[model samples]
Target: MNTQDPLSIGIVGLGNIGRYHAEQLTSLMGSFDIELSGGMDIAPTARDRFESSFGVPTYEDHEKLYETVDSVIITTPNRYHEEYAVSALESDINVLIEKPIAHTIESADRVATAAAASDGVCMIGFHNRFASPVQVLKQYQQQARFGDVHHIEAKYIRRRGVPGRGTWFTEEAASGGGALIDIGAHAIDLALYILDFPQVTEVSGVTRSIFGGRPDYTHLEMWGRSGEGPFNVDDSASAFIRCADGSTISLDVAWAANRPPNNEFVVQGNDAGARLDLSDGDLTIFESSSAGAPHFSDSEVRTRDDDPHRIEQQRFIQASRASEAPTVNTVEQALTVQRVMDATYRSNERGRAVKIDSEPLPTVD
Candidate 1:
């Protein structure tokens, strides 16, 4: 096979995000060389509509689709990511899983093990890492713009926003948890990526179902409309983490909070600080001063320029070709995030600090 030739890709789970990937691939037509091998989805309605609209063969079973494509993209719910990804990788097919990897740390471990055992590449979808502004921040870190990183604060706050609430999202068995596991996963991943993934030594957290636990809370809407159904999961969560390097990360996430000003990720260091606001694709940098003049100074600014999805796709394909390890959120990183989530919930339930299970995460490399 020619190294320059495009690879065949089979996408599993043709949901809304999956459709976006398909459209993006088609939009790149001539410039972006690739073949859409087709897809598989358990949903009959989704499969029929996707095949009819895209003119791509649809497989009801993923095993049949895996036999046809060189690589598979898993975009199913968080709970199913590990099962699907492991199945694909075990069959010697590369896999690109959507965010969060899996609902549990143990499942994440299985996915990583399968990837390591097979002769295929595996990568997790952390699209924010591909943004231009984020890339600049990474470059700044490489250049030591932020000397001796120490603290991070991330917020994924939304104003009355919970997707498919009372549906799969609110169900702990299906879409994982509520807003924290869904959106907060991205924020946590981004913060860890920026900080070079410091080893978390301890985590203390709390979860709240302030809005969805009451009878009157039934009026709250989910996904898009009002009163979709009953929501039982936490609408918000907050945590504090101490890293092995003595650095710290403060995280807060919400599906529907009465707070003003949407979402942001602020990374502070001894020498400088970089803040990325989710509402807009902007990153503001501030320089720290040892000598007193209000304690901080301003520095160079960077902004996102390209579509994060496109860059992420290109990177995954390239990594697949090389059979190289994932530099970003591999299974190990994902499991770490899951550990934090699990501990947070446990702490919330027990009304105290939950001890983390100290175990080394498996590596894709």
Candidate 2:
């Protein structure tokens, strides 16, 4: 493979996100020497729209796109993540699959196995890790700024924000689960990333579908194609996780809730604590000084204009060129997060804390 040659990138699943990926990739071509090979989407309307807008070829079959591109971005729903990702890897093509990896632990495991055996690069699109505040938090952890971390509280709640009431998001079979698997994947991955991907020992959780079946429920924004389908997934979820190192994490997420909208992660440590507001990308560090009288200090940390999705794509291309899997977005780390999510649902069903037996997979240096 010629490292200097421009990489050919293709996208699968031409939905809103897939189009956004195309836009970003198109914009990046000016800076990074790359080619927009083409795209694939099952929806005929979507394929037509994408081709007409981007002036790029669109394929009905993803295998045809895979045959042309050096790397592919898998942006299909959670259910199709594993199938497409595994196929791409098996074909010796690099892949960047969206979050959660797969809809089930079994599927995630198969994808992980394929990634471990493949020479091609595989990365999970946990783009939040590239956010400026999140990048700072990870740096703080590395610098030991948060001394001996004990607990992390993560919440990604939206008031009246149900995505496509009748779409695959509301269907358990298509989406895997509800709020936990959707937005909660972002929350859980961010928390675990900040904590350096701790091994979860146990998980206790509860899930509810209070708003999905409500036809009278009103919302400001509803995403996806709305119609009438199975609303058999949870709209809200809460969970408590215990890690092997004795640290813990409290997670709360919902697509629609009665409370005020909240998207933040608070890390509590012995020496200091920090809060990150995901909405505006602001980070606040809290510390107490014991001089004379105990005084508290709250300092807001400034962040750069970091576009995480763009950064994530650039890094993926770089990693593929180097023939190395990214440490932050590897299949191993995503498998750990997926296992935690699976345990949360199981714990909810069992009405007890579910013990986690899956260990964290290894990452390449």
Q: For every model shown, what is its TM-score relative to the native structure? A: 0.91, 0.97
The ten-residue window of minimal lDDT in model 2 covers 356-365
Question: What is the per-residue lDDT of model 2 for residues 183-261, given as tens digits with 9 covering 90 to 100?
Answer: 9999998888888887888999999999878979888778776868878999999999999998899999999998999
lDDT score, residue 243, model 1? Answer: 81
Misplaced by over 4 Å in model 1 are 1-5, 213-230, 288-296, 300-304
| 31-136: candidate 1 lDDT, tens digit per residue | 6567788999999999998898789899988999988888888888788998889888888788888887887767877887898788888888878778887888
Clashes of each: 0, 0
Scanning candidate 1 in windows of ten residues, the lowest lDDT window is 218-227
Judged by whole-model lDDT over C-alpha atoms, candidate 1 comes out at 0.79
The alpha-carbon deviation from the true structure for residue 331 of candidate 2, after best TM-score superposition, in angstroms, is: 0.8
The lDDT values for all models are 0.79, 0.89
